[model samples]
Target: MMAGAQRSQTSFHFCHNPHAGSLLQGLQELRSDNLLTDVILCVSGKEIPCHRSVLAACSEYFRAMFCNGLRESKDYKVTIHEVSPDALQLIVDYAYTSEITITEDNAWQLLEGANFFQILPVRDACVTFVSNNFSAKDCLQMMQVGNMLSCPDLEKNASLCALKEFTTVSKTPEFLSLTKDQLITLISSDDLNASEKTVYRAVMTWINHDTRKRKKEMRELMELVRFPFMDKLYFLENVDNNNAVRKSCQDILTETRRYQLFPEEVESPCTRPRRTSGLREAVLVFGGLEKMEIGENPAVFSNSITCSPEPSTSSWTRVSRMKRKNDSRFAVAVLGTRNVIVSCGAKSRDVWLYHPELNSWHKLAQMKENRYHHKLAVVQGKVYAIGGRNLSSESSPWTSVEVYDRIQNKWTESVSLPKSRCGHAVAVVDGNIYVMGGLDTEYKDTSTVYRFSPGDSQWQSQTDMPLTTYAITASVLNGNIYVATLTNFLCYKPCENGGSWSVVVGVGTLCMYGMTVLWWESSHLWWL
Candidate 1:
């Protein structure tokens, strides 16, 4: 009876078999021989306790085995508190002795727990799970999240998925808001069908059309829409004379015809005259009295200077001290090739033409008479100096006018003013010079405005200005003449067929000087 009882206890202790018991006893005998072993296992939250027996049964494996499938791993500082009781027991048993037999079915659950715990090896296992299960539907939200987090790999994967379905995705308003250039790349590449490309362009045009958010941007969009048609016209005229080509060109012109004013109304309170050649950036204005002082220690003198844009003020930087000193008046205009011609008042007999690019001055042929406070303008590529005075005697102002032909580099006599006037203002609008309010025959202020056409050599009557303003400034903006009245400013919109002037919005009150009202194409201003 004692022998039988011992056998039963040994069988239960070894668990699997009597030979397994004998082998375990033999392994135990070798324990004192400094033996080493390792084991790894993965199990579900409920299977942890069962893993404890396996770990104890294979004690030799515990010597060097590393277990990563636990919800809490000893590698990082993070401790897992929400582990199941059974899983916790399994983890503890594995920690005490690294022996376990985790089955494949339970491997995924443990891998998920390991991922949550951020155990790198186990987290890697979960990524493998994803790679094995990747699908088109799974990529949408994943890519969005990846992009939001700046995850480069995930963004690429998501973009690939979106591109796969590009042909099928309808061009909704939401889709239109996507980056147009990116969509265009997809369209132009052979990756999409011809129909898809056509649809995309149509949708893009619809989305970008008729937008007036900025006047400049609107103009650009209109140009973009017209380019294809323009190309067709050019191709027809040069490459082919076929009836189809001619018909196509005619149709395009009809579709894209733009009715522009002969004198384009450049939007402004601009301080410079309209360019004869249509271009955007302003030609720099130089040569004027910028400063004046009244003491002898520094030698008091009046000098005019330039002020440019605020940052580095690149447009026009002012220079100090006039080359010659005198009581001065001036008329400034931009002529051919971006050169500015400045005819000074009676201050000097020398005609100073300023070259902005060179930052220097040059003397031109002298005017026929010494005229100051006269109105000067560029008309049809010619400079006309009108109605100024000679201080040679106190006798007073002159109404004589002279036209300087820039192309010929010679002065031609033109029809003189209706009367002798000084301190008057002149601005060229739509090829006609409008000479307005000045000190008239009696040296008192006058409100009369006269229009001169060099083409006809004739003077016509016009409505008087609202006020008598001398030493005022005038500019043209958006095709309308903006007159800087002495204390205020007014707008003049030329009639389409030529009759009268109409008022535009009144600008704010004046800040006066011997100001030249220039249409600073960039800012559109009337300046002091």
Candidate 2:
């Protein structure tokens, strides 16, 4: 009885003090002295901490049991028994002092156990070690595991580190495994400010590849990842440093034309070859010209006509006109629904749909408001009436935005603009509504540009035009926003450092509105 009582007391003392002797020696002593605690071995082959009293209290023989096999086989080797002696000591101290001393060897394993058990000290200690000694490999592995474990802070750190490395050097085969979106996330990060120069140079060079607009798309993807404040300031500055960067990268790419930097361009899945019809016939629609001399109340003439991108050498023929005429600001947009052209603007509230085949006018309902000097854009079969003047006798700028749905045969009012603008040009580039070059309240021309996002229903200011001018024309061709003013044309793109615009070379224009665009493209061509 004396011996049994002494053994029970010794076992109790050992349970209260795990570090009273070597971990293995203490375990052997506890077995000899008496059973102090019961360690539950999960089916995953992981040992869990449990007091003997707690085990005794349970009806089941094991303190804990796995209902099913763990999903990951890697968890098998990461057991409490397999943990190094040093880590075991830390684990024991973590339960007692709540202070964990982590070492590199067992940091990950300890963290796994700590995370599984929801022990704060051990988990934190593991995090501290990993953060301080983070390597490329460690970051890569941790990024995958941490993200899965919902360890946000650790995942963020690992992602940032990997992205920083990707930016610093040309993305390797290993790094290229990251999605384009992920690469973009790193490029736009503020933490990598120190690595910006190297990262930007590498990223710019790598993405500027000539795999049929691949570089152009990468540039766009980078723009999308940009922080909102940075993009706003960048566009407001009116500089297109991308051209210079592109030029430099082009120079580098020119040397390495032999290398296949980008994956072969995949032909668009939705693209269908345009079927050629015999005779290449086209129909011409003419309307009233602007009544220049207001001294004479111009014959309430119906001049606004829907013009197609007709091939050169076509005749002047009248097809359709607006029901009400107010010096129709003529711009034609091809509707996707019926293969018809919609003569959109004139501030008359009425839209005339012209079928080139039928050569007839179909009058649609009036717009929400009268708009003039506005541009029309067709996006996903929806007609968007962008910036223009809300025509009234008082002559004020228009801020109201409207969209027409062909399927529903209705016009719905969208969010308005920040400013009432007129004579502005709008282009839908990658679902972003870019409003550029217009007159404000005072009718003073502007070079300011604003980008409207449908996702947020808000406007974000972007790069301004190089020269302020109203009645400018804007279009997106080959992923570049080309703006043509009365006298000049310029291409503006986002800068590499990312929050400003840089203008490319100025192009010469032969004439305004309907003038031949020949001078800008090549040498000279006559215009009527």
Candidate 3:
């Protein structure tokens, strides 16, 4: 009993003290003092004194070397041939202290040594350091190292960084040094910043780096370029003469020409090798009040259309004209990036869908009610038409809502609003439909805000507006809704239950009733 109790007490004492800071301090001091050092690791004939117990605990290689009856276990000396002395020294220090500084100069070397020893944490740290410091100049090398060490995420990040800065990266010697697979990986990224022409030039340079070796890969590679987006003249004059490009992408070039000359006959080929994945979105405005000559008023049925990159940029270019006149009160909503659907054409049940790419309009199925002053918002790619009046019928303003599925090409009924209202603003945020302040059944502006989810049948009331004024337009940005009234702009926080509307400064005041308000990321593109 005494022997058993003594053994338990010793085991408990060791367990309790194993992770204490004092033990780490003692080990650090022991390392500094070179006390009880059990082994010497030689790298390139340079010796680094180390404790075998610390090495064995921290590294699988050292553990196997010390515990498996290896020659180094008896001799207390192991020669490392794969890594340099500097990397070995860093590894030895990390084994004792559990920390090491990884810089650009020594990162690859340390990673190599760490990988060889199966020190996964050290390898991860090296990868992280390289990933964070990636630039056009060093990213290729970083990617190469990451690929060799089996760190896929690090390799991906490094390759993407190089692709984003391809114009500069392509001029470097490292660009030519890229393996065929590595270059393909760079080109396959969604938003590699280089234009199609620059990419073609870069490919030519890479192939020319060693013509005998890289010539075979030329055809297989040129087929990946998005030639349709490139200039037509450049393809005819420059790219057509290339024997490799002509041979590899002959079918693709013919398709590109068919798309250009006979656009309606053929669907555009969509092989974007290096197209910007980040959206290059622009807002298109159609049919509002336009200024006329001094003696005349602007025609009611007139043509005025423009698309701006942002809400603030001065550069606005003319685009296709709306086929039908658009009133300020009519509901408008964008269905994905391709289709812009306009409904409730001022008491008429006409619904027009506009295609931006083709710059053409087609009339879709009409709504159940011939509603004007109605609200429309898109949730999960389906358009929801909510709360408006039917001017043709003598019915009271609509409190009912319906969803239009693009797939079904028809109107489907949804949950009704809590109260009858018109000219209210509706916004879709976090997959919920929020109906805000508008004229109530009594024709008075109501301060109430209600929320509705797709699956739910009831409209749950949310935080009301700070003021009783009707919300003219609303747009969501970063999960927060910005509600604009006739007099002021208010920001609504949906997460906060009570009195979430806070006054936004510097917006000044709205004199006229604004038709629509949208929230774009870059403020520079916003003109109105």
Candidate 4:
């Protein structure tokens, strides 16, 4: 019985044949000698003898045509249309031997044939060949071909190449051949990597290429130029005075003028700064008390605004100073246009907008409530001021929340917080507001976390923090909220385990009280 049981576990092992690599070679030799050739593929009046089994084994197109009980299955000859003879010959050779040489003169035809034949390996090889040979002069052509062949990788790479070398790509003849919609899509991309002036010039060049036909597209195309972000002198000299722009695009020109004259009043696509123009990722530190001198008062507040270009830079440049010297505990948030909004925390309703390009501060509409130690968050193009204590009111910790309306130039009340708290850390992820650890109305630290969505009447309570700590700072990175407390750095993943908190690193020794954490340059967290 034991022997029979052991026999039941016995199995035969099969090893790979060492000579299997020569099978394809032998098939190629058979095709060379025209031995047992069962099919002939005809392309452009040229015929090539091939094996039905080999073609069927290598190509889905051939398998579907020959093995699906179609009329072509019993036929000895098949005619392929819209494919060049040379491309067909190469594809047939590759099907048998798994190899083909692609040259510049033959790449497009080979890609088209491979795509038509549903041969993925050959199609991928052709895509790689074209991508490796991409240049500024022909990248637009490559992009068009990739689009035609439905090759996403090739199309994306070619598009990126054109954007990175936009100045040179715009000079190519292929650029002039782009359709009106294609031109608009290209210029509207924030990743164009060219100044607004260069984009404007490229539009003009395209217009002039076929002025009789494309001249009518001036208004539609000019809307994508972002004239407010362009150089002021260049806009006035080259764009404003140009006859075509002056004549047909007076309304757009008027909007551009309004943007230039009153930037805060205008919030349009033309006013948003592109990365190539002047928008950059930098660490900005707002109002806080400076380091105390030997004999200076510790209560002295600092109004200087400074920024570090990157995390690696050790030096910080003083870009601008706040208009009010006594501003402290101010809640700051960056607008969608990359402008910094500073709401005074010195028991005043005054708010200021810091324009990075002008290196100046402009006063914005005041808040509805006089509160200090409040938190600010920008969600969905609107700024929300969260909980803080009002000095004059007997109800010290106010639960009211207000949102700043750019169009109305005023602050209106939104949904209030669940609990009245100040010195809380706020961060926005996926258009939702997250309020972290802070001191409650009873002046005791609370570990409760609350999430609020716009247009919702109530804030949803989230998982409690690991520890109850106040004066914490929080920032969102990679869709996770990272909170820095006096003792440790914690991270909260909203999508993990129904939203949970975990300690990321121990920073108790850093004593990070009253510091703000910011995620800059899409990497590296700076505490200030």
Candidate 5:
């Protein structure tokens, strides 16, 4: 009866022995005992003896072939195609001992071998090794290898490297060797760093590489060049001087001329200049502390730095210092990728815009209100400076909202918040403005949430956050709002019956100053 009762419980505590799990135990004996390897793999005139069951278990390709009744299942000798024997041997060794060494020479071929056999772990490992060591110099070859093997992630990474370093990349032999289609795809990208004239120069170089052979394809390739984006001087000097423009390239050059002469005549369209943004995948963090210098607030702006997606390889290098001083009452926003505006609240009553790439500053019109603790957010290119407190007293909260028209260089008053609040968080999610958590007029902490749409004159109340606080950081991911408080992380699903905040468990964390939140492509929150 006791045994039956114990069996009915259906749960057991199982123990594992350390010796049995250790690779140090009896490996020499197992090496000697060699259970008579059932298969031989042939590659590059070399034969590697391996167990068919082990290889089949380690690879999906072999698994389906051996277990699903395929032709290769009964064969004792299998010939590996395309991959060199050294790489194949490494892959086979990994199958038996779960270990393999990847070197610079063998990394690419080893990855090809792993992918051919459908061994994801080794392939992923190779992908990491290749990409972490990637640079503009080797990116072309890496891109070719990745594309040939159909490894999309590696292909994208290599392309990003190439695009970011295009000026140097275009000078390489590989770029010159690219097929017409490949070159067109490259120059057609909006992210290319080179100017349209530079791209035109590159195209000319390619055409002149084997002019007689490539001339037939020149007109088709010329269409990919955005000639209107070229400087008027460069267009006259380069494009007008080219013999191809007078000959077969006449149609494309004519279209560009028409577009530039009459931009309103949209019969032919031309590409406009794009904002300069570094690193296709990255996070921009803005934060500054109020450092008192002998009872004075000096302008203290830190150097601008960018980090790569991989945190370990990144460092913050100072670019430029701030042009002015402020202890508080500061609000910041990004105006496209071209401008970063850092404005201070009342008493200072001024605005400054900085270009990160050029390290240049531009002074702009002042804001109407001068409240410190205000929050600034850019929604669809318009800067919205939200509620804040009076400079004289922290207790006096401002209910007013100011919208900055970047084109006009002026700020106009908009409908105020539902209540006078300060130190609140504002985020733009799916074209709607979501404002959450702040101290009310009485200087008491509250978790009140409000939202405003584009045409709405007044803010609408939403689900209150779980924590009561004057400060919170918000970001949007996968079409949901993620709000992190001083102590907890919460997510709000707008698609749900009535917006509600649900706790997301077990994402490790430490506190970040300024409470800046950004959505990472990896579906995790990046704090700055």
Candidate 6:
């Protein structure tokens, strides 16, 4: 008796359940033969025969209607609103077979029906299909559908696609069909990825598409552009000379003129540079020591500068040189105003601002302490100079930190680092400053990482890096910090598992000291 009871407890299990598919097939065949289906779905004057139990098992909509004591629970025929007949048929087939084909023509209709029927798998699949196949032609329509369906991921992807291809998308009739608020929202983004001239042309095109209806929206639309960043010739010929622009945007034009004439004095959105303007991503080589010959002889520190709009082609153009000669190892950062700020790295207290449009440099108030081999980072529009050594204190690095004051044109003392170090790398992510691997107070390479919030009085220590090396460089992309060390490339995720480090790639023979790494679009790193 005991052996029989034990044998009965040992039950067989089937992970694949070979009969499940056949069971569904049999149910589908029965419904096809009009044998056992108890419910009929009516849509657009057409009827779809389905089993109530099968429908209820797959869809919360049908389950609630049939099992929640609703009137439809007792009825054999139910009318489905909003969903078309073809869409209803597809949904019923999916409920029985657990699979359905999604084509370009039927994707939208299926998505709407699935959303209405609370069929999450089908809805998610439709969203994925639309997002993966998004193009400039259908991005606007997808964005509208996403918004109506309350799918944020789909909406965000579509918006990004439209922005990336704005030059081509703006010429489409769909762009003209956008409402005023929608147009404003699209044009106001800094990530539009189009030149100011192109944006201005697109705005003009939209207004001209319907002159009487959109003429009153001209000023509001034009205000979204960064006019000061436009080319002087384009502004004169296309904008200043346009009678319509003159009539609707006189005050904006005057402000733009002031911004052009006296840029340092003007402080407005018009003066702020767009990401697609002259301030677009480019490789800027600052003043550094360059060898005159190929041999390992003494090199001379020069104030010359160079830039490359596209680094992959290796095409470099000489830009305006720095005013101060023999300036090397300085910290360079782009400010919120889109101007490059260079702090002297040659044991001097001088700071300079470079204007890309004018191709000129202007002097700013100097720092109180001299710094070299330090790092500069911009956080929330303020510049912070991190640790480095000075000539007077050659034995020890400076622990003092300074924040640049643009208004006063001077540097003010801020919270200092816990330990003095030099040759460190600094990066900003989500408004917080991250200082990574550098030499510590012992003048030894350390992998310690420190984080500082502007509102905090002191810096907090996070997870250390994998490699311990100085003369490192770091940059932020997509909310993560990428560090380039002498021998390896590393990525630090601050929000993951209380700050974790991962090795992205090994530098191997490509390793070098005093290198700077910048992250741009196209997933390419510009190394200098």
Over the stretch 483-528, how does candidate 5's per-residue lDDT look in tens digits? 7766677788764244888888544553334434332334456656
How far residue 464's Cα lies from its native spot in candidate 2, in Å, is 1.3
Q: Is 1 or 3 the stronger prediction by lDDT?
A: 3
Estimate TM-scores for all models. Answer: 0.45, 0.42, 0.52, 0.63, 0.52, 0.56
Candidate 6 lDDT (Cα, 0 to 1): 0.83
Global lDDT scores for all candidate models: 0.52, 0.54, 0.75, 0.83, 0.72, 0.83
In terms of lDDT, the poorest run of 10 residues in model 1 is 259-268
Clashing pairs in 3: 310-525, 310-526, 311-525, 311-526, 311-527, 312-525, 312-526, 312-527, 313-524
**What does the lDDT read for residue 392 in candidate 2?**
71
Total residue pair clashes for candidate 2: 13
Candidate 2 residues 1-528, lDDT tens each?
675674434343335465544554555455445466444323344344434333222212212322223332223222444444454445554443344666777778787666655556557667777877776655666776776767777777777677555443344444444446665665554444333234444455546553444465554443322221122334223213456434434432222221122111111211111111111223334444544547666544355454433435454455555455555565556564234444446456677676666656777666777777777766545677876775575778888788876546688887778887888777766556678888888889888888765655677777677778887766555445666677666665633222244455455654335322221222232222
Tens digits of per-residue lDDT for model 1, 1-528 = 675674434334434567655655555444334244222233332322222233433333222222445532232222234444444444444333333334444444444444333334433444444434444455444444445545455455555554555444434333444444544444333233324224424444444553343223322222222222223454345423434323434443333222111111121112122232243343233344434545653322354446543323455656543455644676666664346677766546556676655667777777888777786777756788888787665747777889886445667678888877888888877778888888876788877788887677677767777777777667766566777765666766565344455455565665324334334424456354
Query: What local lDDT score does residue 474 receive in model 2, on the 0 to 100 scale?
Result: 67
Scored by TM-score, the top model is: 4
Off by over 4 Å in 4: 1-9, 17-20, 208-216, 242-251, 258-267, 282-330, 335-387, 391-528
lDDT of 6 by residue, 37-113 (tens): 79888888898888999999999999999999998887889998888899989999998899999999999999999
lDDT of 4: 0.83
Give the C-alpha miss distance for residue 404 in model 4, angstroms.
Answer: 9.7
State the local distance difference test value for candidate 1. 0.52
* Candidate 5 ranges with C-alpha deviation above 4 Å: 1-326, 336-343, 346-366, 391-396, 406-410, 429-431, 453-455, 460-466, 474-484, 489-512, 515-528
Clashing residue pairs, candidate 5? 299-325, 329-345, 346-370
> Comparing candidate 5 with candidate 6, which one achieves the higher lDDT?
6
lDDT of 3 at 134: 80
